[model samples]
Target chain A: MTLLLAVKALTQENRDFLAQYDIDVVTPDTVTDDQLSEVVISYAWDNTIGNKILSLPNTKLKWIQAQSAGVDYLPLPLLAKRGITVTNASGLKALPIAQTVLGYLLYFARGLNVYATRTHWEPFTDQYLISELPVLVFGTGRIGQQIAHHIKAFGGKVYGVNTSGRPVAGFDETFPITDYQAGLAKAQVVVDGLPGTKNTENFFDDHFFAQFNQLFLFINIGRGTTLNQSALLEAIDDSRVKYAALDVTTPEPLPHDHPLFERPQILLTQHTSWGENINAGRVGGLFRLFEKNVPSFMKDQTFIQNVVDLNKGY
Target chain B: MTLLLAVKALTQENRDFLAQYDIDVVTPDTVTDDQLSEVVISYAWDNTIGNKILSLPNTKLKWIQAQSAGVDYLPLPLLAKRGITVTNASGLKALPIAQTVLGYLLYFARGLNVYATRTHWEPFTDQYLISELPVLVFGTGRIGQQIAHHIKAFGGKVYGVNTSGRPVAGFDETFPITDYQAGLAKAQVVVDGLPGTKNTENFFDDHFFAQFNQLFLFINIGRGTTLNQSALLEAIDDSRVKYAALDVTTPEPLPHDHPLFERPQILLTQHTSWGENINAGRVGGLFRLFEKNVPSFMKDQTFIQNVVDLNKGY
Candidate 1:
């Protein structure tokens, strides 16, 4: 069987790992259209070249492993119709993202943001204890659960939102997406960890933000499409939202002269939450997931682990 | 007995609490010079009026309760000569100060500082995992122990510096001030929580900073007199110190155009670490200490609890 590697770059360690398997791993540029059809597996990344390969008529392709957790840009309908198996590197970036969330919470609670922008020596008067604040997380996946775990360690109450309201391990309480109003009302801090999908796009619109009664902090480490940026700005301007820490924003690289950069109440990180010494680990996670599923595929054409639901679009 | 209150302002609750006591409480301005000599106790803040009262010929003043943790600015020699019993509000500001230290650590570990000053969209690559970092705290007092406790909770290794190398509760190891070289050698993050004293002033000088072999973060929530600001700037400029989070700096307001303000590597907080909603609790702690010491003074002229050693100047 042949596996096409669609990632722009792969470390030597990862290349060696692929060499150990009984498959011919080749980059998309090296393989012709006829050879692409013969490929039974692919390690995909979000790029023009990768999408072009996926768009091709590859009848024998059994599975495509995504190097990212969010697969919103992928052709879900086409993949579903062709009966292609899909897996994602979901839990690989959990620790770094969770660390960033905790950083935002502490930043507000300790008044670091106020001090950072201060030109004079006036101390901030409005500061609350982190242990007393309640947090509401908008997803219950690996990333959200890890965030909940860290916040709970600091003695904060955590409420989770998910499709089924299934009890996630670290949350104190779980609420279905349909019944998250109570959680939203009491939350002093709200975290958006939902993936970018048609269902999640503009989920945090003006109406969704209006549910919050008190001044609270809003942090989005999820997809930028999940948030309505205009509504967020209005919330901040009207003092409904006291502060915002956005790791993801629309039109990322944010057009350099964007107005968001001038707002002292907002902290924009340019979608770099999953950073630091995790690049090597990310590739290692993808290879491990691929390796685990390969035995099942060889035996009975069955792929397991991190399989994405086509309709849910996660 | 007359007890002069020298604080700048008193809340209604605090005034009511003092009214409940048998002693006549009077502000510094309200107390006459003749009445001042008759006053046997005082609850003092660090101010010109408070210092003037201390410098006056108050032969009858037996005990003074300092409303702040640091009593370095008081006339220690004069107080000792007069044999006046002095008590400070130590441990009262512990929680807030420790929270600020954790904020600094998380700020650097999660790359919030880099994002705060960025004009472009380049992500920081030098981020570190907080749990893997080693922290060295210079003081075994209430504030230092609390900082150690929070850092340890996050899975970081904590080492303490003290006069006797005595084992502190939350620290994994202890090193005396005389033998802190080994501790400094291995510290990835260093916190100065040492009280301001003649021995400690300018302790973090150029020679002291040169001992560090790797990149490290230096946080000063301790007295500003303990740090040589010029040397700190030099270290940062030379890359010996990767970053600095100074909640306290010499010449308190730090002069608007001080070079430290221009350095992005240093986060100047203008001595506001013990801020937030902890003021009410601070007054309560002082009252509790004063109330406990009063009974002993009334019975046998003995005062205990947070008694400052004049020779030590803390």
Candidate 2:
């Protein structure tokens, strides 16, 4: 039987549903090198195993379903060259990721980040509500839209930034990337949800943060390379930025001795914003997308959603 | 002139507004014992000055505008006997308090409570979304309703517990305090927003925590006396309760070495949920309520809002 390597753990329901199709399933760890020729599809791509499967002499890998929204780490050029189709899990994680963005804002707003470390009870007077401050969200994509939605739910004003500066749902105002700085002075909370791309590299540098007329809170849940860490550190040091919550940093698994880890004002969540309720029977959005794509791919090499352009690498 | 003791700091706007009234304003620190007889109204009650003013041989204190909703700390009987009209600052703090309650849930849900203490990058899979959990709010008053509203905005279900269980505004389901256990098994997040009353004293005890069919998150932003500290500790020790956030505790300022302060699972916020946006010249709800009452108070011995019933002690 033709094989499908399910790189991630599958729920019983997924297994039962896939069983109805004419394909044999094998996990990354369980799939053998000899079976590579039979493996026509891969579910939830893994870097090392993906490269190995592609490198096999008689490999028949035709398509890959990526587990994350960003395919920046995937060998997109190589996949494009080999004519291998790639589909991503984009909107699936927007809800949890957006929820985490609000969580980060509250951590700084309610003074939980400071109070979390205390051993004694001391009332802090610096606490504020989300409604009292305005939030500026850069990149009004699925993730940014969800963030804006939750912020609005808290009675907060949301200013969204996108390529065209077109109005998006849940945002009070929208600005293009070139003009986002115009809204900075009025924003007390700034968030970056821009995807990883050549144009976005080092986008939030010193010049970007210097436009804020008042001290503001910063949160970044987007690609790490888009931000300049030194500039953020300087902003925090000068008290221009009160506190920052980062889910993603320049390097994954930031070095234990990294200065970011030493700063009391910066909180590192280690890119785990997307890790919510998936462990329970809630079966993630990725799997649901995979299930929908399975029948189409099996029949005519097409997908129902999230087909990524390998050349753009998103 | 009849004096009004502005115990708390008054904004310039508030001072200007009070100037238009007939009563002359004086702070507790600025007032003399001889002036006690002239002090007819008090804005924002203070424990120390309240006792002193009431004890004075020839004091003329008539009405007091309490800064907090709870009058448990005040000698209600004495105020009642002295014909003191008491008005409270209720509903004003619902937004911030509810926001803080959600912050506590996120602190645990996003694993910030665990990650805040870590120096290294580690991905925790135990994280869950607020939407996945069902929250049970023990009081469906202003604070409780707001909490239910925010939780519902996140797409979570809310079950409210009140005296009659006759259905509050924002709750998906309602249960009387006597039959709250009927819904406890379905609740993954249980909140205490009940007031401090003789019937509610030590309401959350060993039997209360034991009713949960599964591990659940606990949050108490209500009166401390309503929850039993030892019972909560035992719940944490047994792992029956996942984590807890406490804003109010048994003693206002718990001793530095209290066992509750030492638990990694228990988060204490030092009862500062009400301290939000008030500092930013938003002019607290208390001041607005005071302003509305000032005109009526000067015209006649009456209040426009929040007149507390001394016998009920709410």
Candidate 3:
């Protein structure tokens, strides 16, 4: 029987389907070294188990089904050198992540943050209506498009930024990465959803924030490496940014005394943007994607869904 | 000059427009009793001034342009008996109020409430997406329809309740106020946008909450008189209601020690749903409505826009 390493548990239905393909599933914790060496497919993720498999001298692993959209944490170069195929659960998280971005926006816009801590009833300061606010999202991928779609639902203007100034279906205007400064003048809210990559490193630096013509709410649901924390702090200090909602930080699990936590204007969602219906959204979505890829994998050991380009590291 | 009593300050433009008709605006504080008795029109609201004007024997107050949608505080029956024409800023607040309703929904659904108080990183419990949830809004007028419109934008199902089970433009389903229980089963969030009236008093009491089939979020951007506070507390205690965001509590400025403030599940927004762009929204909208009605009032002492049915007390 072909051994399949599942770092995460599979439903009984999935196990039964894998059995039909003459593949026996084994978990990293319980699987023998002998069984591990013969594993040809890995589902979900576990850093230690993944490194163990990669370090194996005679490993048979041919494909990996990543449980997340961002593959920054994965060893992309090693996977590419070994000529292994990688598939990701990209669009599955778009709904919840996009919903979370709205959550961050509404938190400040509606004064939920202030109301949460207040013991007395006070009239709010000037508040905003999404319909009257213009939002600029820094990536036009599934996640960014979903954010744009939600913003559009509120009748708010949504501007999208991508590698090229190619227009996407939902955005009112599209700007290329190099020309995004032009769209910054009227934006009351800016969101970062760019994936972590060499080109995106520290994309939202001081120079980027300096062009804003008005106070804006900044939200980051993308990789933390794409933002320069010091520059964001400077923007907040200089009053160029009114509030910052960070769901992704440079280090996962930001330390207890981190400076980001000190700012009253900064809200740290702690990288829980993909939290809504996680088990069902991630696992179920991955299983379906894997199910579709199984037939193709069996026929030619390749993918027909969410194939990641190792060079681009999406 | 025709005396016009304005309880609030008007913009220079609004003052200039009113001046075009040879009308001089006077604030409640500055208007003399002689001027008050001769006042033929009033802009905005002040309980003291309204009652004072209403009490004048043989007064010439022909009409009032109210600054808000709800006129419960105004003596409606007295106004009707006195032959005073009333026009309210109803649809003008629908956009901000609707946006606020969405803010309240997203607050609980995306764990903003939890994250707001937390200092450390924690994986969220099962959160929600508006798309997967069903929302029921009572009172399918401009405000309720706006709420439904915003919910529909997120791809969620919105059920609206009105006096009759008549279909409205945006709701997925319409339930008559008398038959709203039929739509209660699937609703994950319930909003009260019903205006303050005799029939609406204590509308969201124990019996109404008892009919809910699932754990739901309750929001009230409507008049606080419509909700029974004790019953809401009970609902929150029993877990039938997960969270409650009250923009309008039973009494404005709920006492610091009010029982409603004791519950962590309840968020008091202090009747600020109409807060977005207030100066412009209320004053500008009222001025425009008053502007459209000015010529009619000058000629026949009647209105052409937002004429309130004093008997209905909206």
lDDT of each residue in B1-314, candidate 2, tens digit only: 56888887787777777777756888877788788777888888888888888888788889888888777888889999989989887787888899999998888888888888888877775788897788989989889999999999999989999888888888889998789887676789999998888888999999988875456689999899999999999899888897999999989799999999889988888998876865644345678877788777788777788888888777
Instruction: Give the clash count for each candidate.
Output: 0, 0, 1
lDDT of 2 by residue, A176-207 (tens): 88787766756888898887877889999998
Native-referenced DockQ of model 2: 0.78
Stretches > 4 Å off in candidate 1? A1-21, A28-34, A119-122, A212-214, A285-304, B1-21, B288-298, B301-304
Candidate DockQ values, in order, are 0.51, 0.78, 0.64
Candidate 3 CAPRI-style tier: medium
Please report how far candidate 2 places residue A133 from its true position, in Å.
Answer: 2.9
Which window of 10 residues has the lowest lDDT sum in candidate 3 chain A?
A: A276-285
Please report, as a residue range, the 10-residue window in candidate 2 chain A with the lowest summed lDDT: A277-286
Q: How accurate locally, in lDDT, is each candidate?
A: 0.80, 0.84, 0.85
Q: Can you list the residue pairs that collide in candidate 3?
A: B247-B271
Worst 10 residues of 1 chain A by lDDT: A1-10
> Judged by lDDT relative to the true structure, which candidate is superior, 1 or 3?
3
List iRMS for all predictions.
2.1, 1.0, 1.5
In model 2, which runs have C-alpha deviations exceeding 4 angstroms? A1-3, A15-24, A29-34, A56-59, A210-215, A278-284, A295-299, B1-3, B11-21, B29-34, B56-59, B212-214, B278-284, B294-300
Error of 2 at A182 (Å): 1.6
lDDT per residue (tens digit) for residues B1-314 in model 1: 44655454556666665556556666765777777666677776655765666667645777778877888877878889888878888887787788889889888888898887676677676676676578999998999988888877677799999999999899999999999987877688999998999999999999988876555699999899999989888899989899999988888877778888788778877776776555666566667666777667777888777889889977
| lDDT for each residue of candidate 3 in B1-314, tens digit (9 for 90 to 100) | 78888886788998888888999988877888888789988888788887887888968988888888888888888889888888988887898888888888888888878878777767576688887678988888899988888888788899988888999999999988888888777688889898999999999999977865556589999899999999989889888788999999867888888888778788888887876645666667767767898987887776777989999887
- Residue pairs with clashing backbones, model 2: none
